[model samples]
Target: MTATLPRVDTAPAAAVKRRRRSLGWVAVVPLLAFTAVAFGLPAWAVLDGAFTDKGTGAYTTANLTASLQGAYLTALVGSVKLSAVSAALATLLGLPLAQAVVTSRHRALREAVLTASGVLANFGGVPLAFAFVATLGNAGVLTRHLDLTDKGWDLYSFWGLVVVYLYFLIPLMVLTITPALEGLRVQWREAAQNNGATTAQYWLHVALPVLLPTLLGGFVLLFGSAFAAYATAAAIVGSSVPLITLQIADALSGNVLVGQENVALALSLDMVLVAGLVMAVYLPLQRRSARWLA
Candidate 1:
């Protein structure tokens, strides 16, 4: 027994395993640290400030209550309305465009469209607002040439803002839906054809059913993007558009109300709630979509 024990030394192997485990934990530390600093800390600040009264430093629900009343409520409604409209239009427009690109005979065309979508999807805020304003503003070249002002084309109005939003939202939808479209297995279509299903029948029965979740997910994604937009709307419509984001900025800057910074935080909290609801719906649909697309 003593000779057997002497021959079975495993200390070095155990030490190596322990060292690898330590390294694994060490690798994870930086990421955890970054998350805490970037998201966790800022979130805590918002929550704390949202609940506290600036004057007495006492926690209260008045700010939250106030966010749901009067102009604040209107702003929230406006934001929701704009986001829904833009997302719906973008989904309708982009799905077919993406389908066309995906089914295109020319590989170069597909590549060009996809490349353009990737770039345009990310192109927004000040520069985009500037471009639209220059091209569609009251004295803009197109506005002057086409007499769009006479046709009721006000670039700073609700419909105009919707049009501006669509510029980026459409590209975003194209980028999002293309992958799901590509994941449509060829065998499924062939199987449907062998069963004597026409193109419309195949899509109505099979393709649309499989893609419904992905479509809904894309809509939610676009909705969130439009809802959170600040800079572009700020640059274009300014206070003319009463978005929740604009309300938040106003509160923070005392542009509309002084000593209302906590109320702004509360509005931000409301936004967080809305975003949470969006994520709640989107995540489940996205997971279902992944099961099919994978």
Candidate 2:
């Protein structure tokens, strides 16, 4: 027993292990700290502020109730309507574009179109708004050239906002749906055609059933983007037309209804609600996609 194990020591080995653990922590700590400071902290602050007291010492639903009022409700409806219509139109226009991109025999043309979509899709907000304004605004050169003098159109209206939303939404739809279309078996279309099926019949029976999930998913994405838009609408119309983003901006800036924290809380709740609705559409779409593959 006295001579057991030659009196071997594990202390140095344990020390080396401890050093490695410490080095791991050194790497992990920075990322954890950044996440807590940047993302987690602000999200917590905003969410906590939503249920907090405005001026009174008591916490209440006053802000939440205020958000459900007629004006916000109207604005919410308008936002949804515009986003839905624009996304629908964009998808309709984008399907063919995607098909062309995916099936093109010309490598150069396909590459160019994909490049164009990527550029346009990312070019939302101020640049897009300004571009449309230059083409369609009341004092725009294009408008003047078309002999539409004194018959100026407002690009600051609800419909005008829809048009701007479409410019970006179409490209997004194309980028998303093209992959789904490509994944589809080309033989299915050829088989139907060999059977003398019309284009309409082939689409309805063979293509649409498989494509519905992807199309719906694309729609949800488009709707979310449009609903969350602030910059384009803000830059184009300012406060002339009531929009949810402008309202939120005003509240956050404390520029309107001074010191009224309840309004901000209410608007925050409204955004949450809209976001929830958008996510609701997402679940069914995912399920449908699974079913399509099954």
- Best of the candidates, lDDT: 1
Expressed as tens digits, the lDDT of each residue in 118-138 for candidate 2 is 888888888887898888787
Clashing pairs in 1: none
Question: On a 0 to 1 TM-score scale, where does candidate 2 land against the true structure?
Answer: 0.82
The global C-alpha lDDT for each of the candidates, from Candidate 1 onward, is 0.96, 0.80
List the candidate 1 regions with Cα displacement exceeding 4 Å: 1-19
Q: Assess candidate 2 and give its lDDT.
A: 0.80
- The number of clashing residue pairs in each candidate reads 0, 0
Model 1 poorest 10 in a row by lDDT: 1-10
* Model 1, residue 212: C-alpha shift (Å): 0.8
Root-mean-square deviation (CA) per prediction? 2.8, 5.9
Candidate 2 backbone clash number: 0
Model 2 error, position 92 (Å):
1.6
TM-score of 1: 0.94
